[model samples]
Target: MSERTDPRVVVLTVLLQLAQEARQADTLDAFAFVAANSLKRLVPFRNAALWTDRPARSGVSAVSGVAEIDPDSPAMIWLDALCRHLAEDTSTTGPMGVRPENIPPELEPQWTEWGGPFALWLPLRHPSRQVVLGGVWIIRDTAFNGAELALLERLGEALGETLSRHLRIGTTRSAILAALTRRRLAIAAAIFLLALFPVRLSVTAPAEIAARDPMVLAAPRDGVVARFFVQPNQMVKAGDKLFELDDVDVRNRHELAIRDLAIARTDHKRANQAAFADPQSSAELSILANRIERAQAEEIYSRELLARSEVVAEKNGLVIFTDPADWLGKPVKTGERIALLSDPEKVEVLAWLASTDAIVLRSGAAVRMFLNTAPLSPLKASLESASYEAQMSPAGVLSYRLKASLAEDEPPPRIGLHGSARVYADNVPLIAWILRKPLATLRQLVGL
Candidate 1:
């Protein structure tokens, strides 16, 4: 045989080569796999496993000669339990030989079924910090000598340094992944429970305080509005002068009719006197009488028009209209709406609900109106009726007209006060309520 090389030199050569290989590993998992399988080059072993203490409990991360690990497998499960039990023993800080008698009674059967006659536990620790990062298990039929154990310890330290370097590079990511893995089940359970929580399905819409079953005041004459006796939102009593039309045309007609009546009466009086003297004059009296009757009818009609020129409130209520400037000198047609006489105490909530947000509202769905003037104090109301068809609202949006009655116990709001309203429908799951709008939009886009 050729001259034998010194065993010390051989061991040193192998240790250096393994250290270089560990350093070259690109990831922590790669380094762990190399550490578990490559130790056989210096110390012979039939099987090997690597366990990490990164998590709360130690877990077997890699197995020698196995490309993928099935965590549920009996062997892996047993090994994981064994690693967790062994990690709890703080006294075993260094390489220790594990024998059949060394294992606890609870794990004795599993150890006997899967372990070899001799097993060596090599704790991987930071060289400078001396903190345990992980461990390696070597199983074989024969006992591990002192020299081999010493070499394995050096190898463990080298591998641990390499692992720590990779860990430091991805410390944030590793910590996040470890935490997520540990609490994944709890997080999933919490989310599932939250999705099933019951919530009231509701929608928001623009609202206004409106008159409920109030009298509408329309223009009674085809003439220019000369003056307004009552301002917008002014309280007025029955027979109060609300507005007046320009009386110039009606007064002119009245004067003409009065003059014509005077002329016809004068002519009639002369014919009646002449009829007693001349028979032919009596025929003229009949014609003159007819002319007087026609003039009387014209005078009466003009007098009625003069009376209608002045508008009056029919009932005692608040008068709601636009700015007085908009109506002054503005000519209006007969029967055209000009103002509203509303009872302030009998007010209602008028909401313009968007068609997209419409739901199956019950007869008495709850409605909360947040008025612009007093948003802090919302007015409670109950839905009374909703329009069957959507119409253009005053703001020019297509919306459904919803009328709700304000709570009788609460004082009614002033007419025409604007606000926002929240209309609540039937109860549904929280997930459904959250996803309602998104799903509606998706359906519209997809035309499904």
Candidate 2:
């Protein structure tokens, strides 16, 4: 029921039977050992070879039996193309025979252009039935006839089956390893999530608020701010004597003016009363009247200077900064700042806004500010004023000044606390909120 067995057929069949058993070996090393021995015994070719496709490897054969198959050899052109084509087509029988139509255009030229006189291709079929496992290529210079072709077919089939089996085992082994790794990672993540893992956030450039108190205590006279009776942070009421300057010279001048005025007044009264009785008293009366006027003017000026010596607080507030204690004896000019006081309760929140946001910020827009130290608690406020012009920040970013008054009563804010606020605007999608920057960058680059 079949072609009669010739001596060559008998020997080839027996060797192939043994080779199939040896090729059936599980390990690639074992399969290779069995295949080489079988090929040498069955065929008269000077050299026998086996090839396989390896992940992430390119050019020439990744796994090869022949040492001459250099990794970078140009001879790999045919093998590479054959392997790629076979890797995609899993249904076809490898090395049984291939029509010119069945061969891909990419490999058609290589079949003729390759240096080898004969070449064999076998698809390493996958056992999972998902896709082609890969392909193997056997090349030689001497062409074979029908009998030799048959032997090569059997060899290719046996090799393909062996590769398929090993590949399945390899796949199973890889899947197990991957599953174990995933389980370990999941456990680690769970443990980390349960512990409330703390994330440390640091800010190199923190937000700053600028503020100032309009109430300032100034020196009332051209005298040193002597005897500073109050220190910074001390509370004082309106009209409280803050400090007193030395008034010894002014007091002495005032006393001298008073004595001169007394003598002039006495002479003027006697001269005026006697003026009607004697004509000579008229001249004396005029001189004494002039002297009394000069004395009164001097006395008034001296009295004003003495009154200015006792400086008093203008309003109720805590003093922020006062003149240096050592500067008590030093002379000071009029209108010089001696101390600063501010009502801590009348506080306003100062914030920086980008020029773009500043344009949209109205005078009554709502704002919620959070101090860096108390991030969880927010201070409600409303925009009171904003500067029209923008200023360049120290880091060269352009921003505009914004001011707001606290809407609720809270503890007095520290002068230099870092803070930020959300000036409510229109809401957007969550995806847009997260990927806005990256998407904007891509759009800019691609001109989309």
Candidate 3:
């Protein structure tokens, strides 16, 4: 086999070289490398300077390794103008705009200076799609034939494809790196939130007021039934007589005893006087005085019996219960209870709550209570540091007693007022709402 030296072969070989150059350069610096190396194989200007045109910019980097030249240099200015023309044409006519024979007069001077009569300006397309993005100007010494021009066009195409591939890779890599950085910041933000905002814990329960039951008043000794002066539920002051028993018999006995006492006194005085008058008669007088003293003792006993007829209240309260109204005229036994009284102003609100709903109940919890009849208003209350012993309600339902005290501004909750209380507990994590019951059950069973 013989190596083909035909122009077509040359063109194909050079185009392949250009594509390889672009593919090899991964970074933006590879642009300089690609332009420099790819241009070396073709017959172009002796020394090539890559010129990129902005509004007023000239030559940027040189492929021929020449000394830096002023951007204002005539040759450099012409090169920039040529690049600008190529850029404009490619923008309008797509990537195949620049060809060797179409060189304008103003750009000729720069081509001549760079040592090329025919040159090709190829546009580097963006990685997104096939289009003329920027121009790649090549320098050649002589006017090239159609075959050479065709070769340069093919080289441009390969360069465009390669550049597009690299641009896509660069864009994708940048996007991935940005995404990673963003994710890291998000994680940090979550951690910061956890530290700055902490969860709080608190105890909660319903409350109610409690009072001691009324003290019992009972008879201390056996006595006849007294005549009652007041009816049930009547209020009485301490020391006021509540009932009076018949004392006629005891009163008569007391009067007889009083007369006997007076007679005893007279006899004792006579005995003493007799002893002073005559020693011989003193013994008989003393015997009479002894009998008088025995009679006087009986009189004192009758008087005491008469004084026990009246009954009195021990404390101030309404008379809660009275057995039979006619019992006042009958005999009464010792230790018999007369009445029951309870404090009125110091009453408590006994709120019954379902056991399941009372799970959050705890001492010191704050609550708001509203009577069933007074639903429009609420009274503030606090847990009274105690709870009722758990028991079944009258209706056979499990419930707990919540004792609450009215706040300073509120009136004491009247006894027997049916009301409900709302207790405030600390906020918990949102997830706990679903898991609260199961967790509580587990803890109870495991004793954890």
Candidate 4:
């Protein structure tokens, strides 16, 4: 017989052609159509359906000779259930004939109505994983013979490999579309622009209102403080008594000086009276006169000490000091600060910038002071000076001393009012401004 007339040659040619069509199909939907309708060329089937394990698409994807699939339809629903039941049989890996007697009792009733006298189940498996990806269901009026089942088994592998490839490509394409959506792209652009935007480089430090060029009042001598003549923040005039030291010792010294001076004068008078009569007495008069002069000097010095026991203000201004009780009976050394005489209107901001937060600043960089008492009313100032080297602050931190002059138009806050200062330097990119501290810490840790 001629090759064209040979039945075996015809079957082999159709199988090869179907396999090529499956591989050449551009999409999963197209391949599903081919799998459901085109398989009849090798084995005749009255109806055919395709099913998959994908959760979002777990149902009959296509039906023989139907361009569109209505999943809600009774036939489609029943077919989906039947395919799922058949796919669970792990023991039947090859093409097998299915009949009512072979299926569970629950599916027997539906088989009589929806299925034909014989059905063929072909499971699609992943080429490498050997896991079931899905299956194809075919029903016909005639029973499938052993030769037909064997031919279908080979075709099942080709279909399974093609279906698996399409599923993987679909998943990758879905992921790419999801990640490149317009909303996500817009958000990324916004963040990138924000990082590049310019902002004034700034830092916050501890600050307070301080007197400008105020006169400091310290202890005049080494003594215990007896009393304070003026209260803290009280306005005072020049020569007003500010405070006093213990004067008991000074008063006693003055009294003794006076007594010694009196004795010296008496001795000098006696020597002068005797000097008029004898030469020896004349020599004694010179020595006695010198003694009188020395005694007079001592008396004058003691009187001055007594007068200075009470300290007075040198200028007319406000007296700024701590609680009066703190200084009462408190011992002080010479030149130790006791109080400050400051003008109420003249004030400046004193900020302690930590060494870690220090930045390059000019003479007139902007500074804003937010007081603890009145934070809403921030006082504006311009940097006047910064210490050349860092020093230990009262809070036990090494920091640079910064002095900023308050704006002329703004009223100065009360002296000694504590606050925070925000100092602004040259403009820089927002990203650099935000990462400045973290980058500095990283550099310190890595030594790079």
Pairs of residues clashing in candidate 3: 44-139, 44-140, 45-139, 45-140, 116-140, 207-403, 207-404, 208-403, 208-404, 209-404
lDDT of 1 by residue, 86-135 (tens): 76665665788887787777778887678999998887765543356778
| Candidate number with greatest lDDT | 4
Q: How large is the C-alpha RMSD of every model relative to the true structure?
A: 14.5, 10.3, 22.5, 11.7
User: Which ranking of candidates, highest TM-score first?
Assistant: 4, 1, 2, 3
* Model 1 root mean square deviation, Cα atoms: 14.5
* Model 1 lDDT on a 0 to 1 scale: 0.86
Reference-based lDDT, each prediction: 0.86, 0.65, 0.61, 0.88
TM-score of each: 0.59, 0.48, 0.33, 0.64
Model 2 lDDT tens row, 69-182: 454555566556655665666566545344445677866765565524555555554444443444545556566667766666666655665665654545664577578889
Candidate 1 wrong stretches, greater than 4 Å: 1-182, 262-294
lDDT by residue (tens digit), candidate 4, 66-157: 99989998878878887888888867778877888877787778887888888888998766433677899998988888889888988998
What's the lDDT for residue 423 in model 3? 63
Residue 427 shift from truth in candidate 4, angstroms: 1.4
In candidate 1, residue 147 scores what lDDT? 89
Worst 10 residues of 4 by lDDT: 169-178
Q: How would you order the candidates by lDDT, starting with the best?
A: 4, 1, 2, 3
